[model samples]
Target chain A: MSQLDQSGAVPAAAENAAPAVSLSGERVLRVIVPLVMLAALVGLWAWYVQAYNIPKYILPSPALVAQSLVNDWPILGAALLVTLKITFAALAIALVGGVVLAVLLVQSKWIELAISPYMVILQVTPIVAIAPLILIYAPSTQVALLVCAWIVAFFPVLSNTTQGLKSTDHNLLNLFELYGASPLQTLFLLKLPAALPYFLAGLRIAGGLALIAAVVAEFAAGSAGAGSGLAFRLLESQYRLNIPRLFAALLLLCATGVAIYGATSLISHLMLRRWHESAIRREN
Target chain B: MSSAVSMNAVAPSGKPIVRLEHVSKTFSNGTIALKDMSLTIGEGEFVSLLGPSGCGKSTALRIMAGLGDASTGRVEWPTMPHDASGKPEREIGFVFQEPTLMPWATVYKNVWLPLRLHGVSKAAARERVMSALEMVGLDKFADSYPRELSGGMKMRVSIARALVTRPRVLLMDEPFAALDEITRQKLNDDLLRLWEQFGWTVVFVTHSVFESVYLSSRIVVMAARPGRVIDEMEVDAPHPRGVAFRTSLEYGEFCRRASQSLLSAIGANDHL
Candidate 1:
């Protein structure tokens, strides 16, 4: 969602000076259907709870969930910060590691052949299977959690960026050669800029993955005392049978994921808006 | 310098800019792109390599630019100067079939690329960059991206970029083939004027007889299926070939003869 929206809205949007008054029926339907569905879902949930006289332990009412969110603000907020920090740090580390590895990989065919199989093995191997191993090796639980998150978040970035780098226009490569451009000049001026869209796309995928990885790792770590993240909070709420608080924490995580998507999309828009076709708005 | 080209060395300078001596290129997969080709380009000559697709017109041009290796023979640059590195330094500009502009860069930056690679700072290259754009009549669009320009405008930027280095030899591979007829004609006239102004040797690759006759002082007609040159013609027409010359009797005569040569070149394939 972040990649698509940014690619569309970043570039050529300034040319759209006129405010469109005649919204098409399809566009209207797109907005109306999802919103109507959400309202119906919440209404059904409320009605079902009241009509069945369901207890709060099994499933909290929508109103009760909202009340829990407001009431448990301080605890949830701290947990949200911890989760967000781990997620963002892992994402940052993945970005640098992935792009650097991609650049080094593309420098030689031998290097790529030697390294790619291991990367594939890493990608295919489940992170859950490795989380306990990482916990066993690392001195701190935080480091172990970060390692799992980093492993999960790094591949999409490396692969997409490598594909982008390799796909540099053949004609443009010829052009660079014709101009007698040095290899370094070609890499920076041509290959890197060409890889921007792919990198940002990778960033978008990695953003959501970073969040999920952090949570999963936190679950495996199972830190119960203080300084725990939202995932641990979620496990604690479940063990205590605090269903409403669990739902509230789950709600916060979902909202955080959406926020991550929104942030990546905005960055893509700002960076690619000037010239990329994906960011351009054509007159239909 | 003679790494791949066959040894047929001779470089007598006065009139000729470069000599192609029995050059042939056959790909590793056994596809012959150019075979036993030979041609001599004179200084300040507006020469067109005119033939159909796969005729080695482009392959011949690439050999002259030293962009491709000729498996059979040599390309002798009569006037190429030797640098301190003991290699003949090349000062050549090549334009491709497409505009091939970097979409991310502004038109000014696109024109400035060659100079930038040559270690000229942007501030130092500003005048030259603007002048190249001015030659193509796109100075006003210096700051605009390639996508924002019309097709013709983008090609003009491509031309500006090629000309930015003030190369002694300009090689183009059907640079205007994708444009509409009107834009093609306009660019053809503009190109001729630039040739006259720059005093550079031009080896233009095109299939259009009218374009070749209108622009060239000489046309080298090529045949395909093991691409090789089969015919050559000297167009007695002068520079400043305009709307009047395009419709004139002599222009038609050159076009007619050129067309006949082209047909025979294509006809060579029918025999096979």
Candidate 2:
């Protein structure tokens, strides 16, 4: 083969047609289109509000929303930080709990039989229904809200991780056993690594839901006096008929959710980029 | 079982290294995968388990590898060496029907798995892994993932992983059945070269007449429906069997006889 290569026997055509990864003009347009559309929508909303002489109370123009955002930066910023803290903390707890439960469930059939039904039940029961009850009995409002957010985030991680652990290639497991690998070796070397994509997928979903649950729990608790999160700001704006601030708060919430998703997705991509098919960049 | 040995037919290089004594395997699903199968593989001999799809060829190979237990009888591995310290012990190397690589890992890591499982660190096992890859002519692809390789290349990596342990016994279950004819022929040649270099006992499973004839020094013909060995044929061919040997009249003669035995075994199995 080396001789053939030196003699130029390998045809250039036989070389694989790998996808070009450079950001060419066509690639730039894919990113540009979404930004252009978003600008157009905002531009149109501003024009419509002005042309129709709409009252600010009913629907504020995009300019007014921006102004509200600028003027209320301190309050909204604090609320944003609070919500972010709750979201990430709840997500961290959920991740640890879910993976632990999933590992235990996979370790034994009896544990899965004993607890899987309850997991399904926990998933089925909407967090909103029990947020108020949790708030009333819990020692502190923040702890109650954290518990609510955790409850919302935990199920997806548990279920996806469990499925991923169970989905390890049977032949690989047999090979491990043939080499006399202990149970712990199989779990750490085979099962957990295999579960990574599933766990990341669950984290992405849980990221969004944790934010939603935090806000929902704040609304249910009605405990807003200085240390509340973005959801409380949203509720306060709505009750006080502060339409522009409401839109501004909603805008921040949406942006935060998108940012959280982007971060998690970026993490997933970076970790799996080497081998997983999902993270691999391919030709269009 | 030792007294009933059939060394009468084999022209193997050495004494029996592995002997299956009245081995029968009945799966929990009530399927009799193998019944009363007996065969002996000599050291440094290239043996093929050739039969139809559902025959117990694969089952027999798995039993020999200690991956599956026989419900009745036993497999005697009298020549399997055991030493104290056992730090670098090389037992049996297995290649399944599929490549069975850990897709999440690179080729180096995949090939490094058996050693890794045996408590050998990656840094310590790197030299062995690289040499094994070089043996299969895939040393350059060590950093590449299994998903990036062609079907034949992936199978080579699988073989490289199997060779990484430097085992005394090699068990392959139809390892080339998925490849194209040209690729299969190329792998057969490469495998023959490796076998000659290493001189390990090989129990290869396959369903192809020409492949079995071209590769094995001895071919064990098996059948389904209570899968069992029905006949065994000695290739009586020289070492380093090349493409010329594959096309020779002697090769054709052995294939014809093996094909007849396989057919008759299957026909007889249908009744039992």
- Best-performing candidate as measured by DockQ: 2
Provide backbone clash counts, one per model.
Answer: 3, 0
Q: Give me the overall lDDT of model 2.
A: 0.85
* DockQ score of the complex predicted as candidate 2: 0.47
Q: How many Å off is the CA of A16 in candidate 1?
A: 5.2
**Candidate 2, residue A155: how far the Cα is off, in Å:** 0.6
Please provide, for model 2 over B43-90, each residue's C-alpha lDDT reduced to its tens digit, 9 standing for 90 to 100: 888999888877888988888877778899888888666435231136
- TM-score of each prediction: 0.90, 0.94
TM-score for chain A of every candidate model? 0.88, 0.92
* Residue-by-residue lDDT tens digits, candidate 2, A102-209: 999999999999999998998898888988789888998888889999999999999999999999999999888778787999999999998999999998999899
List the candidate 2 regions with Cα displacement exceeding 4 Å: A1-18, A21-23, A281-283, B1-13, B81-89, B269-272
Give all candidates' CA lDDT scores: 0.84, 0.85
| Cα distance off (Å), candidate 1, residue A119 | 0.8
Considering just chain B, what TM-score does every model have?
0.91, 0.92
